[model samples]
Target: MAVQQNKKSRSKRDMRRSHDALTGPTLSVDATSGEKHRRHHVTADGFYRGKKVIDTGSNE
Candidate 1:
């Protein structure tokens, strides 16, 4: 018996890699043009990168 750890131990590592390749990078859209963009680090000023951050109340 043995225990596996992390991504290397997972047999689905290749699948994960493949998905990442297929999607390339995560980028938000303008909902108008199909152009791509990236998001910078989130700030505590209720803004993510440069866009306004919508705070959805907890559903708990």
Candidate 2:
């Protein structure tokens, strides 16, 4: 019988996701595209500040 492997176990793409191709703090994904949405890319200073607040549920 064939075995199923975890996706992350497979070779990861050397290319950074287009989403991370920008300056931001957290990354979100498009609801449908299944692509990484480059949003909230901010500097550590701004991130800690009120630049953008509220719990995004991200480990931050």
Off by over 4 Å in 1: 1-23, 31-35, 41-60
- With a 3 Å backbone cut-off (N, CA, C), the pairs that clash in candidate 2 are 23-41, 24-41, 24-42, 25-40, 25-41, 25-42
Residues 1-60, candidate 1: write the lDDT tens digits: 877665374556776676665445566643333334554533333455455575545545
Worst 10 residues of 1 by lDDT: 29-38
- Per-residue lDDT tens digits for candidate 2, residues 1-60, read 977575452235434343466554567654434455446443332332234433555675
Worst 10 residues of 2 by lDDT: 42-51
Instruction: Output the lDDT of residue 43, model 1.
Output: 37
- Native-referenced Cα lDDT, model 2: 0.45
CA error at residue 3 for candidate 2, angstroms? 68
User: What is model 1's C-alpha RMSD?
Assistant: 11.6
lDDT of 2 at 27: 70
